[model samples]
Target: MAALRAACYVPRVFTPDAVLIERGAEETPMARRCRERLPDVPFTVVEDRQAARVAIGDDFAAAKRRLVLAEHRGSFLGHCPAGTRGLRCCNYLMMNFATNCPMDCGYCFLQEYLAENLPLTAYVNPGAALAEVARVLDKHGDRRFRIGTGELADSLALDPLTDLSADIVPFFAARSNALLELKTKTDAIDGLVALDPKDRVVVSWSLAPEAAVALAERGTTPIAARLAAARRVAAAGYKVGIHFDPMIEHAGWEEGYRDLVATLAAALPAARVAWVSMGALRFSSGLRRAVRARFPGSPLLTGEQVRSADGKWRDFQPLRVAMYRLVRRYVEEALPDVPLFLCMETPEVWQRVFGAAPLGEQALGARLAAR
Candidate 1:
């Protein structure tokens, strides 16, 4: 359980250019932590979240560096939007404590999804999210809710500044009906290990090859460091998950993935890994424009993708299936007993890989949510 870089490990800190606080959010716990932690950053109080967005002036990607603490008055927990009409949805759920990630991964959908939502926002009122979760779990007492907070933000990236997870981890640890999944591409687990999840939490990491990471995933933890952090978390008595999502079909991609899987298999023991999921690279045509404008040299734009039934451009079905089967084969050979699943994929693709698809998204979600 020794860390590869623990002695010299410095948490990848995210220091925003300025912190904008929405009027009533000033006294919120999240705002207080940011003020206390980021004493050097200038602070401004805005009338509302939209006003804070107007205060920050930068391109879409660069705008992410500005932190906006505001109140989210709407519902917090909802079904993941990744499920498309024809796809076999994982029945995943998402809770956004924050609205956007500080890291600028080239393929991040927020570039298009949140085109108007400029600044990275941390909803100062987390009690609302916890309350929403309690209500859902109360109603669905017969079911286990596997809720993830990373769909709209890097779950752990803002941990140092917001301390949101400290409150969330213990909350989920106390519940039997909820399984909180903290997914991230950062090695920011210092606050995590100090807590005991009691097996009600999963610390998951989304990974790509080291070279792919070096190119497009900016300001994130290296894959090696992520795996090392996973080991440490697993040793600390928490089950970890792996996501090889948005798997890019870059040149020499086969070799890249082969080596990447080997490294992951070596670091992640089967028993410690709760689940491993994969999704081929796919994005809306609008996001393609965003990626080109932001990262002109990104290799993600080089794939032979075609629009799928979901209306997003994805690798052609045949090629996508081939890549999944190959990676599935690699994982089967390496981590023989771990549960593997596909994310946001068609039933045809699911049938081709696993010989069958779930009865429906709810059935799939029920199966994965089981303790």
Candidate 2:
């Protein structure tokens, strides 16, 4: 977690040349960090979020190249793990501290979730929003909540610029009923590691094989580097979470995944890992054409897919189960007793993999809360 050759050293990723600052966000800490990171990047004060959008342009892909610092007038905290029918929900709370990610993965749902052409926006007033989160936690004192910041964006992709972890990690550390999970794909952990929050903070990484990383997940840290960073985080006294969600299928996939699991196990021991989650690639119908167009020849789009009851296109049941089982086997071999869960999967799939499932969403939430 020490500073590297350069502060902002992510290769082949977008570093904003221009920052569109909304009126209310100009003096906030998040905006100040952005300005400090890119000292030469020109800043234009816009009247509102819509005007900030105007400053970017009409092309969604093009707009991602710029950064927009705006006041998030909307709620920052919400029900965790937004559920779809037929899939069991985890009930983890979702924290929307940012809107979009700088990394351009082929299967990123935000490409279709956020408004096209809108520049990535980080809420400058997280302190206030976190106050609201505290109020909610205080109201439900008897219940435990696991909240994460990666639902809408890679939590730490822009952390070097935003320094959000310094604010969020400490906030969650003081709360007894909540655990703040900063889920990301980048190695930008220097600022986070420096803070050294207590055990309530979970540093998580989204993982895939080298082939899948090279083919689809562009502009993120390689799997080896990510595991290295996770080791550093664990050494810094924070629990780590690993995710293999959106596991893609391709030739030589088994060997590639086995190597990945082995590498992770070598990097960190089971006691440091809070949980591991396996999820197969699934997307909405609208994203099918988007992924194909954005990442031409992506194997993600070439899989056998069917419209599930939830209305999203999923890989065939047997195919998904096979992918999950393979990953589960490798992961269990590495860290047998570490808690492993399936993300957004059906009860039948759960039974097939784990032999038993949580009784309900509340039960799942309680189990994860204990972790």
Candidate 3:
């Protein structure tokens, strides 16, 4: 790990000059690890976690980019894909190990979900939360629980300093009824690769074309580097997954995605892959203004988008179906047997794209668990 960090010149945004710790959380392993990363930084122990909001001040968007660490004193587990109703949900559980990404993509919902100017926080006590998860799993050992640690944060963005994956991977490896899916955009797989192989753990990546990544998803690993890391992990006996989520309708989008599918197919081991997911670029109507405000020249906002029945903005149904079909065709050619599912889309759209839909959320959950 030392040699890997020395060789990689990745600029870390989670390094804070001053860290605010919730009084009781100051002595945890996560906090100690954080303090070690910024050795000379000042530590302010606060009685309440919300009291640190003063440091956030008036401009939250601006403060979010700065290096400020906060110890979260809340539960780390959260409800994911299940919260959005009337759709084919995978019943995925969100492990809120961390919050607020260091990499600021233009379309991130963190802008709305997190308090403005809240420093990037890592919940130190996921052990307590995992105990609760264990209780639930203990009762339903026959059922599969697909939990992920990337809904609110890129699972590996702060891994070099925190070494969170080191603990997380092994914990999931011991569990038979659950799978820990570490979804990330960065190629921070060094710590992950060093660990023993865990068949129950899925290291997944959020992918886009090189062009779209540069335009919207900033401060992420290059597409080529990501695939290289995926290949390395697959060779190490881990089931890799890919997410073509937020599939942007950028210029030359069709050609770009087609080439991306070909690249992934040629480079990745299809048999070791768990599954692939697709979701078109969709957000709340209010988020359009925020996205525009954050990225003034971003072309993503200029593309065709409409408010669907779900009261969120998305490309027209036909255009979205067309994009999915094009990408699916290319991807299926490469990963012939891999399960290709949609994220947060209606059953009608599912039937249109895949010719069928899951009977219910539980049914979809069981299907993904089998994978």
- Compare candidates 1 and 2 on lDDT and give the better one: 1
On the 0 to 100 scale, the lDDT of residue 182 in model 3 is 88
Better of 1 and 3 by lDDT: 1
- RMSD vs true structure, all candidates: 3.4, 3.4, 4.0
Worst 10 residues of 1 by lDDT: 1-10
lDDT (CA) for every model shown?
A: 0.83, 0.82, 0.77
lDDT of 3: 0.77
Ranking under lDDT, best-scoring first? 1, 2, 3
Cα lDDT of model 1 by residue, 106-202, tens digit = 8899898888777889888898889989988889888778999988888998898888878999999999987899999888888888999999899
Off by over 4 Å in 1: 1-11
Q: How much is the lDDT of residue 190 in candidate 3?
A: 82
Candidate 2 global lDDT:
0.82
Please give each candidate's TM-score.
0.94, 0.94, 0.90
Clashes of 3: 1
